[model samples]
Target: MAEQADHADRADRAGHADRAGHADHPAYPVGLRLHGRRVVVVGGGQVAQRRLPQLIATGAVITLISPSATPSVEAMADAGEIRWEHRRYQDGDLADTWYALIASSDTTANDAASAEAERTRTWCVRADDAEAATAWTPATGRSENVTVAVLTTTSQGRDPRHSAAIRDAIVEGLRDGTLAAPHHRTRAPGVALVGGGPGDPDLITVRGRRLLAEADVVIADRLGPRDLLDELPPHVEVIDAAKIPYGRFMAQEAINQALIEHAKAGKSVVRLKGGDPFVFGRGMEEAQALAAEGIPCTVVPGISSTISVPGAAGIPVTHRGVAHEFTVVSGHVAPEDPRSLVDWEAVARMRGTLVLLMAVDKIGAIAAALIAHGKDPATPVALVQEGTTAAQRRVDATLADVGERAVAEDVRPPAVIVIGDVVAVGPHSAPTTGQDRPGDQQ
Candidate 1:
């Protein structure tokens, strides 16, 4: 009887603590399915601009009532992404609203909107006041298909910066796969052509990474993410695509046959190529071959090396008021080659950024062709080798001396050459090596 009394006293103490924790701060967290639901957003300022994207992504039927909106919000309205009413908020605006957000600058307008939502028993969030708001906004994050939201409340009020920081930390863990693995597993009897994004392992898309994790056999290109291949389990087979030589028309045919043969045997084949597979990776041809054999296949787009490599070296392909246009060109063959179809002379006359891939061998003749066609000899140039990787290096030179300098520096293939005034505007353009100008000899 004494032991039973002691147990009852302990249970009573536990119940009191639980009640104390919930006192005046009980928040019921629930994931609302807002798709195809009616949502009314008031104001067109910065706060509304920030919240509108999440609503659009959720496929919410948004009725925006505002006198004026930010440039981004205006663009969305013009594009017909949302229904924008160019007027002030009315009391009847919340009549059918399932959710409401008041972010207007005027406190009077915000108060009026909130009162209407209360009358309708709709959840309302006020950007200007946390204490007065019936609903609090949470910091939102996403990784793969997973969503994470966090809200931090302090003794004084709510702290958004703290919440966002926590959200960012959680997102980083999700991205690196330390916190969770991929949800969808790629099954066999098909092939996936994935763009690995330049030479960086982390740049690949979330879907590409998930599919690759389930690969039974990965046919990898020389430019593909080699680091990712190393991460594969021991059971996975790694095939070097470069080892398979193509002398003539049979080369592509051989690749097609390889994919078809492996997939037919019930293996999940991943054709990992550098940058975007469709750009210059010949991905469509492989897909065609698979389709001819009636094989299941899908293509995942990747960041193209043509643009990404230049950006990695701090060279913007297009700069406002500097270069309004950019063009990607292949220089695997010399300009003088009869088989080359690009009009080199016409390209030289255009004032835009020129990105050259596989051009290290023919750069001298190409530069000469451009210069001969009235391109400036002193046009700034940058060669980004092995871009977006540990072995990356940038060599800055002028159109007049790029070929000679590249040879002198021993710059090799798998490099992107950027030409035009945009090159001079990059961080590497400043002569750190004290050669002619900044970033030269880097």
Candidate 2:
């Protein structure tokens, strides 16, 4: 008992000395070269959860020593990204570890791991006590290829929250282009399918914009943000995707071939489409085609117009106490047409928002069919022309008068026809023209 007491006394003193030494010597800011090195993490709680991802990204062979860990940490272990020991930290857990993170809430266990790390000549980080840690983790932000790390040691001592705020601000600036990235294009050679989001240039995602800037060849859709094309450099080859054979399958194949051929010719190609590629845009076909040729493809998803267009015009597809469901259907063909597969009778029975895309031409026939199928003639409708763009216009009508109203108002194609009570809830209330004018010819 006396010998064990003396050893415990020695361990306590050693821990106190280690803490004092850490406090006396401020941490020198440096990024670790942890690539392909063994890193031992002695804890599986919240603190370890935050640190594990950074270590994993560095290509570190992580060995997590803990009886139990957070669900995310457990998931990482399950995914084979990190090796979890699933046991308490033993004396020599850090034997082959090049770096150690002692994040256990149990101070004694943290001390033991830190001591083991120190003895093995490994850098150790302590979450419970930064003063006891030989190394400190910096708040980090990455923008494109640049990683910005902010360490608050003495100058901004013990204020990780402030450091993180600064890091976030830097990241925000990077995303918004307030901080300039090198104009020199640096994306890897491959085909990137970017969703341009409706017809607005600003709605394009940050990654999409960055990739667009790097594109050597851009295959642009007709409905894609046209303003973005004007911004591209003179040297960039821009192909009008709509002009590529009008047959759906043929056009898709041609677009895929263009992407593959461009990439094969050592050009970075971007297939920019309006709305999400998978949402009626047939983006996966392009991706699958690229995959067959072993050509890498990157997809940047965009906001779909089915939701965005209505929402922009102050029409929520799903509203509380009004609509719980919304159905978006292509209106290219008439319900009476043999090629049309839509169940007009069933659609008429549904008491939900009906968003009709590409249906302006056959909308009168569609409305007539809906009413014939037991739909109310007074169901409100809002025809949004070129929604979410400069050419945006809304014409109010009802199922009974929408067809005639459309003819009277000279409503054109490329308009979204919103039907249901949700259309009544639209912010813009343009009174429908009751009288036919001389030049109001459809």
Candidate 3:
């Protein structure tokens, strides 16, 4: 038994040694110059078409060899963007090429080309068989004056599918200008998990602005303010991670995985969110995930709907002489189990403020529950929808009447509800167009 144990240990050590050896193999280096370099592309379909433009963009002198080329490739050939060789790849096609790309649908042909490139000591990328290639192109991205290249080597054994998805996300970020220019003095790329400030572009912070200007990739949610994105440079990559309200979305696990992957690729990534990342933004969860992977992350706070919505409508959550304390709650809960985690009775007795987020749909039921739990129905409630934006509207009424008033005012999602004496202190006594109030446009 002891001999068997020794043999098992030896086998494990040998396996580890083999992996280390594979890691040491030279394939492709990051940020390699391809300008004016001879690069041969094999194939003529969409895959090859997709790979060609990026190569051309990098100033690679491209020679495309295929029986037929896609119209886009044909156009590029006509435009003198690339040299189109009207034939299939031959054994010696890569002999004179400095670098080769195999984007053909035939895996067999891709493998053969990769093998040829290797034998000829030429750099080669097998789009269909990335593992068999001498090197692989990462999802390439560029933003304004910034350029980001993500390379996944087979030596690391990272799954190509996950790597490709991550690369696509990075490319999207680069096209969106969310990835800022790299700081020359500091080699370390900074990360900012910015809250997009409750769906209003103007509400984003100055620090957020600075970080956006410097980021190489912006990983933003669907609900994030669109105007903020509009300001980004045209080349900046913007990736939409299936964020939809009351609909299916890209799983949180997928988003977390993408974040870690991009950061690992050494790009300055911004996990842009809809509200304060700490306030139900899941910022802490993402931060923990990043920290676990040994990636540095920093939180850039934003105007959370919890406070901003009420404040925008001239309602202070905490009034010095009136309500001295405040509590924020999530209104998004199962109907049958609405009071599962919260002590409604305790909240009723606290004599403080209650700010409800995502509670518009459940406002009536919540008001009834609070009243049933001994809270006064006469408690003033202020609902501000689309807060701090040009489209903002305010609804002011007692807790007993606020829900009905919200319906009358046509208040929508991204609204904030403040329940306390602070609602009574506001100048406006009824629902009014947000434009009527001073400093409300912000």
- Predicted structure with the largest TM-score when compared to the true one: 1
The 0-to-1 C-alpha lDDT of every candidate, in the order given, reads 0.84, 0.84, 0.76
What is the number of backbone collisions in each predicted candidate, taken in the order shown?
Answer: 6, 0, 17
Tens digits of per-residue lDDT for model 3 on 1-442?
9999898888768745654576666455666588988889999899878877778988988889888988998999999999999887878888778888788876777778877876676877777755566566765555435566665654566665676677777655554445444456754654679887877677777567656756667888876777777776666566666466687787888888888887788777888888788887788888999889888998888888787777777887865456667999888762348355776667778788999887888888788888888888999888887787788888788979877987887777877888887788766554334223454332
lDDT score for residue 126 of model 1: 92
Instruction: Quote the lDDT for 248 in model 3.
Output: 70
lDDT of candidate 1 over 1-442, digit per residue (tens): 9999898778668745654553356456667678999999999889988999998998889888999999999988898878999999888999878899999887898999988876677889998876666677789899766899987653245678888999998877666544545436655479999998998898998767767777788988888888988777788888777532122223666778888999999898999888998987899999989999999998989989998998898888976556768989999888999999899988999998999988997899999999999999999999999999999999999999999999999998789999999887756455322213333221
Better of 1 and 3 by TM-score: 1
Q: Tell me how many residue pairs clash in candidate 2.
A: 0
| TM-score rank order | 1, 2, 3
**lDDT score for residue 105 of model 3:** 74
Q: Which residue ranges in model 3 land beyond 4 Å of their true spot? A: 1-182, 334-339, 427-442
Rank order by lDDT, top first? Answer: 2, 1, 3
List, residue by residue over 1-442, the lDDT tens digit for candidate 2: 9999899889868867866655455568888888999999988999889888988999999999899999999999999999999788889778888889898877888888877876666888888877666778899988777889988765325799999999998876676444546656654679999999988888988878878876899999988899888877789999888732234333667888899999999888999998888877889989999999999999999988898988888888866556767998889889999999899999999998999988887899999999999999999999988889999998999999998988899987668889998887644655444344645532
In order of appearance, the predictions have TM-scores of: 0.75, 0.67, 0.53
Off by over 4 Å in 1: 1-26, 79-92, 108-112, 131-133, 150-166, 169-178, 182-189, 243-254, 265-268, 318-324, 336-338, 348-351, 367-381, 396-404, 419-442
